[model samples]
Target: MRKSELDTPCILVDRVKLLDNIRRYQGYADAAGIALRPHAKTHKTPEIARLQVEAGAVGVTVAKLGEAEAMADGGIRDIVVAYPIVGSAKLARLIALARRAKITVACDGIDAAASLSEAALQSGLVIDVWVEVDPGYGRAGVLPGADLDRLASALVPLQGIRVCGALVFAGHSYGAETDAEREAIARNEAGTALLAAEALRGFGFPIESVSAGSTPVGRFASAMAGVTEIRPGTYVFGDVMMVKAAALAIEQCALTVLVTVVSRPAADRAVIDAGTKVFTMDGEDSAIGTGRGYVVGHPAIEVAWFNEEHGILKLPDGERGLRVGDRLEIVPAHCCAVVNMLDELHVLDGDRVGATWRIAARGKVK
Candidate 1:
């Protein structure tokens, strides 16, 4: 298979670039004296996860139990369910997963902790737990201080749960418009998580792991004082968001959508085969020059709109270099979401096409 032979609206991952990203992140973590447990939700493929582990990743982090089970089935032993899993049916599967591999979970409240403990106790497993700290994401996680201590204290009475330490996701760091702003958020993520870890320790709980993760923060991981683990997903496939934030380079982008120019309706506009279905509505970035996605080689073109199957492209300079049947490579704003929209990614080792990697964890958002 070759790039020219691949159909439009397809995904292509440069193997060399992918391997480079894996090793680069691992090297950074090694130099900082921290473990790199990459988030598998980015690629959602066991093949990629294995490569990450082989490249010195301590383990893999997943956003759901379904993804964890898929990775575990794919032969990954050390897996962390980064999301809080609740309910009996889900807990049963969660515990069953514990029987096969070492599992750690992140929970923000005592209720989540108690439910996890019940699941662990049912399976007769002592699973490690991380107290999620709200590092300004306002998503999940309890704030540090009384809430942190309270969760740890609640876990003390639980038979199957052990408080490992603290974890944080500096998602707000992604919105940073400048290097200084990004670095500032990175420091905040590390500092806030460290405070929670220290508070957990002050309560006489054993604080073994302090984890902070985000591609933006991962760039300045050295700011993470007292952090023992770092998990970054998008570093594997630098998207438009990472590129605009100065966290990644355009050349470092490993994943892109192969689209074909299907219509040249006007001189200032054209249409491509790829649209929201392929590149998705990953949306805008402050630093990125375009919305939805940016054409890899055609800076003169902007992806202005999408109509499911059609991509509305515009030329700011009014120069129509694109013609009907022309193909374009798009670096999407969010590679993770773009990946879930597809079943397989056509891979490349330099110019030669490699075997396709199945999205083993797709739709496993349990």
Candidate 2:
């Protein structure tokens, strides 16, 4: 089908740009001698996950069991659930998944490790697990040192859980304006993780993998001495936030939402068919300037605000040329969230629709 025939609010991925991004990241990982495991939560499509693996990703990292299941069903063998799987129902599903694929999970607490171990024992499978260390985010990870050591020790007694390595996410350093600053923060975080791993080693545990990454931090993290794996998801489709934050160039952005101007409300105001539902409302917390999104083709037009179904566009006083029914593409402020909001994505090459891929793992929170 032609690009124009696709439904409104549909996610569009530029196939060429997406492939370029994949290769660029893979090249970095290869040169750095670290395994590239692009997070599948960004695209949530098994086809894209396969593409990543084909592009030299050692495996795919998913944020949830449902994503892992989808990738497994699509023939992906090496899968890592980057989040802790708790509760009986989710653990049961995780155990079932372990039987089909080489699975790994993240744990930050004794209870979670014990639960996972029990589940793995029940399934009669040994699952590789990583200890999530909190560098600074203060979210879902054990603090370095005593806390982490406690969790690692607790996992030793678990029958089916194997401590694979340490995982640290350096997301808090993405807003740095200078390259030196970003690198410094990344080095500090990596150093801290390496130290923690050394402590674990001193305690007689083998540390196989030292993974740390965030799209912005990954640019400098490749230089860290001990990191063995780097997981950065958004680098696959650079979004407006990443571009403005200096993580990627405009040309690197592979995703855009096609919207038609529905109204020219005033000389400086216009309205587009895309809104909060289409363009994610995640720009407020971004390091870049606050805005709904950026008009892909019109550099001067700013997406000032968005309602549930309409986007308010503000054109420069004398730059109001867009008329009603005019189609314009927009790069979302955050591509990952935008992907989650849609059920399918249209793969396009230039203006032609190349393929259609379902967002199979959308809303897989459990």
Candidate 3:
């Protein structure tokens, strides 16, 4: 079967590009002497995660416990739950997962560590955890120096939980407009994580892993000293946002939405069968242009507007060539979000349908 024969508004992944992307990033990690624990949130497919492991990734990282459970069920043994594990119910689940795999969770406070310790002790398991450091995102991590020191001091007495290292998500690099800015963000991420690790070691804590970087700064952070591992989720499937950030070329985008032009309302307007439901509300960088996605073959055309189920295209001047039933490929602004909206991905071998892979962890937010 061909892409054209598939239903409208479906996701397609180029198998060749997918494997090439995995090998490319793995090669970078290997050359930089850093371990690659790719965040599995991008595809949420265990098959892809296994591919990364086969390509030399030390393990896989996940944003949620449910995602970790999914990967573990799929036969992955080394897993990092990048989010802080909280609550008695969730802790029970975390301990259960630890029984089957090597689980390293992220913690931001002494209270979280204490809870993890209690749960692990109850289950007769020791859980490895990383202290999360904020890399300018003001998200879910403590700052380096005093903030980190305080947390470490309080955590030292905790039982059944050992602080292994510091985890940094330099997600702020996603907003960088140039290569220099990305490099700076990467340096800051590396510096912040290294500072935290050094401070912890000064406090007599055995620090081993310094996991840092997002896809935007993976290359820079991986090459920096003291960072033992990097977690880049979106490198496996490039998107328009990565293109805008200058981290990936459009051709490197392995995932694309296949949609059919259902209506041509005017000379310069046409509508496709994909919209916010297919491609999330995530938009491209405004400085570069305005669109939720990039038209694969039509540069001038823009996804001018969108509704819940339809995308309005502003056709290029003098081009009324888009007719009903015409199909087009779109690179979404955020591949991770786009993928989470789907239940399965139709993988393409060249232009023909190759196989279908279930998004094993789709909507696994627990």
Clash count list over all predictions:
0, 0, 0
Candidate 3: residue 299 Cα off by (Å): 1.3
Best by lDDT: 3
TM-score of each: 0.95, 0.95, 0.97
lDDT of 1: 0.85
Candidate 3 has its poorest 10 consecutive residues by lDDT at 283-292
Query: For every candidate structure, what is the RMSD over all alpha carbons to the true structure, in angstroms?
Result: 1.6, 1.7, 1.4
Best to worst by TM-score, what's the order? 3, 1, 2
lDDT of 1 by residue, 1-366 (tens): 778888878889998889988888888788888999999999999999999999899899999999999899899999988898888988888888888899999889888888888778877788898888899989898977777777777767877888877899988887878888888887888899889988888767788989996787786877777889898999999888888877778889999898889999888898999777877777464245666677877766777888889989887765587789888888888899988898998889766688888899988888
Off by over 4 Å in 1: 286-288, 316-319
lDDT of 3 by residue, 258-309 (tens): 9999998899899999888988787563234546677887877777778999
Q: Score candidate 3 by TM-score against the native.
A: 0.97
Query: What is candidate 2's local distance difference test score?
Result: 0.82
